[model samples]
Target: MSDWPPHPEAAAVPSLSDLLERYATLRDTILSLENEKNELGELIKAALLRGERAETELYRSSVRVQKRLEYPLERFREVFGDAAALEAASIDRKKAEALARAGDLDPERLREIALVKEIQALVLTPKGS
Candidate 1:
């Protein structure tokens, strides 16, 4: 990110203190810019609702309504009966994993259905010679 004109300290290897200061500056700048962007986005959404259609030389904005259905389980089951409520049921991953690990279920099938995900960040890499 410091690559455009190249930061002054980049001329030589930056000390850890210099890197920490630069990191804080960039982080704060990003947060400020994001806040500004979110405020503008809310304005554009409101304009779209008023049928004013916010547009710029480079971009045009349109609004779409996204919806989700949530039901209170006991009340819903009383109204719709058990079969309809069956559609809303989900497997408990931890219990399923326990069974699979014990060889009572196919681990591969569990993996497919569970769709577990991991979050990772790039911390370091070996330099190429």
Candidate 2:
């Protein structure tokens, strides 16, 4: 990154190729750091798993134990009955869109009621793949 910002006073702006190369390098570094961080996190959790605590000059860390229960829905229904939970949505959105486009479902109604979202993405693929 010695040439980072690419000398703003220079006559030439950075090419897209140069910008992409820098972006890829930074992304790889971030991924490597993330992997190392995750490994250290596992070690910390293992140490704290025995109801232990650890501290450094700047920080103290401890793990809190929690219990969660899991059971079959039928078991729950038998114990509590059906009224506790209600069916929410059954619509398959893609099918609904296809029907709307084919003039089965109302297109105007879909447009009026559908949630709209728009996003921009920059994607980089491996050169040979």
Candidate 3:
């Protein structure tokens, strides 16, 4: 018989203390990875929020400009006495109402709104407008 105590597997397995130490190391590693994941998630969320806010501000500015354009357009019609102007306004009102109903107005995107108006003005080219 050997001097050491007999073991079923010839004592090849690691000691209890060694196993405990390995387990602690693995646990700490998992925790660190989790923390890193959380930090990255927070960073992504904040960046998205900032982008949304900027887009919203631009849209709001555009809405204000669009309102100003409407006033001038109305005044021009009042002075010029053009029938086509009234018809164009009817179309514009319908479009605005449709956009509103479709949730596509996005009153916060001013540059895009202005571009749309400019394009419409060019395309429609109301007689002598």
lDDT of each: 0.56, 0.56, 0.45
Query: What TM-score goes with each of the models?
Result: 0.45, 0.45, 0.31
Off by over 4 Å in 2: 1-3, 65-129
Regions of candidate 1 where Cα sits further than 4 Å from its true position = 1-11, 67-129
lDDT of 3 by residue, 17-110 (tens): 8778877987998999999976854564455445532233223211111222332345434543355345446436455445445664433431
Cα lDDT of model 1 by residue, 1-129, tens digit: 446335667667767887788889889999999999878767766666677854445555566554322344465446545654464453345544555578755667445433334422212123331
lDDT of 2 by residue, 40-73 (tens): 8777777776666776655666554543223234
- Evaluated at residue 82, the lDDT of candidate 1 is 69
lDDT of 2: 0.56
Query: How displaced is residue 84 in candidate 3, in Å?
Result: 76
Error of 2 at 105 (Å): 17
Residue 97, candidate 1: C-alpha displacement in angstroms:
13
